[model samples]
Target: MDDSVRALRAQYGGTLPGPVEALPAPHRRDLAAVLDQARSRQQRELQESTDASLAALPKPLRALIRKALGL
Candidate 1:
């Protein structure tokens, strides 16, 4: 599979369905773009949540937590 298809599969969390695999290159690329956008948004949201969670911790403990967790 080409990069676009591989990326699409990866974004889909692996092993794309048969229907998706059967789509034409252009449509697959479009789907891949959509999935990429969704993944990016999810990652951004997760990072924001993590930062907020960390910020809620006591300042003195925050550094120790980050170091212990390798964040």
Candidate 2:
């Protein structure tokens, strides 16, 4: 396996379920790019959801909650 595959497997606790090395170089790069974009989108969605939830709270409670959560 290549270093990228090995790194991902290690990061995922050896539970990566496919032959990552079998992919052609171009396909691998495309897949990596797509996965990166998906990760970014998911993070943004999570942050937006958190912001919306926090905005629904009263200002004083929100400030206290934000302080307690270190946000």
Q: What TM-score fits each model?
A: 0.77, 0.72
lDDT of 1 by residue, 7-70 (tens): 7887778898999898988899998898788888999998899889999999999989889878
Best candidate (score: TM-score)? 1
- 25 Cα displacement, candidate 1 (Å): 1.9
lDDT computed for candidate 1: 0.87
Local distance difference test, per candidate? Answer: 0.87, 0.72
Clashing pairs in 2: none
Native-referenced Cα lDDT, model 2 = 0.72
Error of 1 at 60 (Å): 0.4
Candidate 2: tens digits of C-alpha lDDT, residues 11-68: 4566565666577656666666677677789999988998999999998899888888
Off by over 4 Å in 2: 1-18
**Which residue runs does candidate 1 get wrong by more than 4 Å?**
1-3
